[model samples]
Target: MTHPRPPRSVLSRLRSQLVVSVQADDGSPLRDSRIIAALARAAEVGGAAGLRVRSAGDVRAVRAVSALPLIGLTKTWRTDTEVYITPTPGEARELAELGCELVAFDATRRPRPHPVAEMVAAIQGSGALALADVSTLAEAEAAMADGADVVSTALSGYTPNSPRQEEPDFELMRALTAAGIPFFAEGRLRTPAEAARALDLGAHAVVVGSAITRPDDITRWFAAALRDAAERTVSPVTEAL
Candidate 1:
């Protein structure tokens, strides 16, 4: 089937800008669609060039409140396969039909229910650009070859084969840049400086998630740091002894 080509203007709007991922973890108090919509509006007010939203319900909610370009996906856990992000073509089509400018899907080498080309076609066929979330350079290359419009370093640390680290996958970004693959810098980018650094490293755009929207995770990070610092404090009594 000949699909309507995804508009190039949507990509132009995202270049060198921040795309806040406004998703709440399962069971979080902020999981409500109303709260997600509010957070999306806040991100827009803060000048986010776009938004990366999860789930069809949240996408509809955010779409209702904001006009920024949306990169949409569904994080459904299937016992049959580990590829959760928009694992099915039906899910990808739904996101595009719901008005997402781009649809993101897991593009890793892990066994999946569907082929990468099929997923890309689904997104493009529904009139949205395909954003392949990849863990390694090989996956990005494969996804591009499979007709993905762009790739993101969103799954770099999540996959077992990729480097596991506390910080964002700068190494993967560098590899992508060196190989001349267009990609978005995502995953564990915690600060504005890091986001700026991503732009400096040849990323098409930067996608920030937990640092901007997951308040519970942010609070835990701070709490853990404080606890470690308190443990390391050298008391005067100890010094004297």
Candidate 2:
């Protein structure tokens, strides 16, 4: 069955804009829906064009506070499959029903509980656009062929098939661009410069997460850098000797 493409107005609003992912991992102190709502508000104040939120509670909280378009998903860890992002059709429908303009799901080639087309239909049937999070160009193409409205580079570096690196996957972005696939540049985008670079590489838009929302992750990144610097430093006495 054919699904309607995402509205042009929604896509136009996101073009060349920053979409912040406001989510806190399980066991994180900031995992509360209230905190997520606050962060979403802060993102809007900071000029985020859209939000990528996780879980129904957090999405509801964010919706209560901000009018920015939302890209929503659920991370469910199952012993059966590695496909965690909005793993089930029920989850995708729930995210769309909760007012997400777009529902994101793992569209990687790994074994999944449901087919990519089923997930796409679920989202579109629920009145939302389907945004497939993929790790490779091949996966992106497959998802589009399966009726996904758009793809995001959010699974890069997370999948074993993709390059695991400290930097954003510019290679994948370039590949997607060359393939003429419109996509959101996400995952490991840590700075404004990197975000801008993704757009220069032909990304539909940029999605930044840890650098803006996850203070714990941001602190760890800084702490690790400082530790590395300290380890590289030699004592003054050693230098004198």
Candidate 3:
């Protein structure tokens, strides 16, 4: 069976647009749902076409505040598996029930409790599209084959088979495009330039997280860059002396 497309409204909203993923890590002060809603509203004001949010509470909050398409997902760590991004069909169903236009789930080769097809069915049955968060080209192929409406490069750096890079996985994006697979560019997309470049590379859309919503992560990025620059300058001056 062919993968079912998202609602035309959702697809039209996201085409060549930015989907800001407003996720705060476990210990972040911004982990609260209120802060996530505020970030979603800010992204809306900043012209984000959609929101990719974690957890049902965050989804509800964001939905309450913004009218944009929402892609919901859950990150649950379990002892049995490394496939944590919306691992189960139940989780996918819950996110869809929370008003998610699409639900993202791990579509990697890792051992998963619920088969990819089952999860996709659950999302579809709930009236939401299934977005496969894939790590490799093969995974992307499998996800589409298993009826994922769309695939995303969200798992690139997280999976062992995928390249570990500080930059966005444009190589994976290109590969997906060459294979004629529809996909969204995500993971390590830290700048407007990179996001734009992803679209130029034929991404259906781009999803940016941490770089936009997580203030702590953004602060660290700037701090690390400045520290590296300072060190480089100091080393050169010391050598000259």
Candidate 4:
């Protein structure tokens, strides 16, 4: 059966803008939807292409504030497994209700046992598109088989075979791009330099977090820099004396 192409907003269709993931954690975004909304608006005003939000409340808040379409993901976990992002059709369905234009999920091969194909159908069924948050070529290939509308290199360094190294995994991106899959480069992208590199490597877009959104991480980065600078050895003996 043919599914309607998922609704794409003007902002979502653009490829050059930044997609900042507002970490909708329980501690911050969860506790304060206002902050999430404000940031979403700021991001929108700041020329964000889209927002990758975790919770439904955060999604609603952002949607109400800005016209920026959302990529929704629910943190569905079982028995110590840290499977954030929709792991089941049920979770995807729930996210769609919250105005998620494109629902994001972990499309890895770790036996979610949720019938990946069924999840895709459910996403289409719920009137939302699907984005596979994958790591390697294997996972990306599998996600296509399961009908993922888009594939992302979000977990490159976090998964086992997906090396935990820097760089945008250009080899995998090239492979996916060769296969006609749109690539979104994510994971440990801490600088604008890396963002440029990902685009050069043919990524359709890039999602940056912590480095842009999470102020706590920024605070720590500056603090650590200061500490490092303070600890530097004194190398001035013949200056003005």
Q: Which candidate is the best by TM-score?
A: 1
After superposition on all C-alphas, the RMSD of every candidate to the true structure, in Å, is 2.2, 2.7, 3.3, 3.5
Decoy 2 TM-score against native: 0.95
**What lDDT would each prediction earn against the true structure?**
0.94, 0.94, 0.91, 0.77
Clash tally, candidates in order: 0, 0, 0, 0
Worst 10 residues of 2 by lDDT: 1-10
Query: Per-residue lDDT for 13 in model 4?
Result: 80
**Model 3 lDDT per residue over 40-142, tens place:** 9999999999999999999988898898999999999999999899999888888887788899999999988999999999999887998999999999999
**TM-score, ranked from best to worst:** 1, 2, 3, 4
Global CA lDDT computed for model 1: 0.94
lDDT of 2 by residue, 1-241 (tens): 3345457689889999999999999999999999999999999999999999999999999999999999999999999999999999999998898889999999999999999999999999888899999999999999999998889999999988999898999999999999999999999999899999999999999999999999999999999998898799978987898
Residue-wise C-alpha lDDT for candidate 4, range 7-30, written one tens digit per residue: 555335847667888874556633
The collision pairs in model 2 are none
